[model samples]
Target: VHIIICFYSIVLLYPQKNMPQQSEAIVIYTGWERHALVGSDIRLSCSFFSWRWTSDDVTFSWSYRADGARDSIYVFHYTGGAPYVANKGPFRDRLEFVGNPGRRDGSILLKNLDYGDNGTFTCDAKNPPDIVGHASSVRLLVFEKVPIQAGVITGAIIGAVLGLLVLVVVIYYLMRFLVARRVFNLSVRSVSLCLGLRSKLQLILYGLAVTRCFFLI
Candidate 1:
């Protein structure tokens, strides 16, 4: 009885050794917001990672919810190497599956978007035992004309500032060079003038000495 009790305790303590472990899937998306222009097409990017091996059995489902809508409707579905797009909704003919299940991509393209298409998009993926995970979502913003991104504007500003600084530095160096050359020329002219004056003084002194010697003789 004691031996049996000890065996049961060991089994209970090492239960993981008797049972295999399963990992859950992880869904990825391009953040919580995406911007698009009206009457233009946009690709909703999505991918997933699964601990299990990839196969055709991997499935994907895309859904959408309007700005204020409480319920979301299916937009696209894929399984068994085939796709089933929405056939009777606002996205009926505008949704296209552009992803490959073999590569774990669940991206979709929405064409000819309208203002009403501004909403949230969700992507869900399943790979057999890795079917349990949170779906990824991205909110879409439809605009008449998409505004320039802050990053682009900031980059342009920084580039302009850097260019201005470079121009200023170049101009400063040029001015210094010009001034240095002028000062060096002035110094050379002063040295030449001093030497000329010394030579004239020497000639005057020699003439005086020669006149004195002739008188003494």
Candidate 2:
């Protein structure tokens, strides 16, 4: 009777702990806003702001996708210094773990980023001993290189400038001719047409110059 009473009292006083409270896990990073050029390297950095939990049992993995496929584009698992390529098809060699996974640094570098390598990449943390944190995502934008023809852009600008100079010379000669023919009224329409043509030509040249600037960028 006494034992039964004590057991009942213990049960009432405290409930069994199925699981402990989850620890707070968060990822922090910066410098991922600007557009990444094609055939260049892209670094997806993931840093743990505050990892209060103690667990080496947790598995660190990274999943990435470029084409929004039904499945993960690529997945890497870090067991030790060597990362296991769990699901790497196209990004076999191009993908490299920048730092050790055992630490909080979860940055990854993808070398020679191709056109197909433009998409969002996700960093996942799973199976933590105490708390399970959600994955973080980074959007990647790849800029395509403009295909400029050999000398076509420069040629157009130079041609436009030369043509404008020639037109100006012709206009000056016509104005002088009209001034000498004091009885003749200068056709205002002709002057307006020449100015309009010059403006249009200058705009075209400016467009070409802008394209060149973009190419250089």
TM-score of 2: 0.49
Look at candidate 1 and give me any clashing residue pairs: none
lDDT of 1 by residue, 49-166 (tens): 7766786688889889999999999989998889999887899999888987788888899999999998999988888767788899999999998989898999999999999999
TM-score of 1: 0.83
**Best candidate per lDDT, number?**
1
Candidate 2 residue-wise lDDT, 68-157, digit = tens: 666665557665445676544767788787854456666778788777776777776533543445577777777776455457899999
How many times do residue backbones clash in model 1?
0
The candidate 2 region of ten consecutive residues with least summed lDDT is 25-34
Q: TM-score of every model?
A: 0.83, 0.49
User: Which regions of candidate 2 deviate over 4 angstroms?
Assistant: 1-34, 50-54, 68-70, 145-217
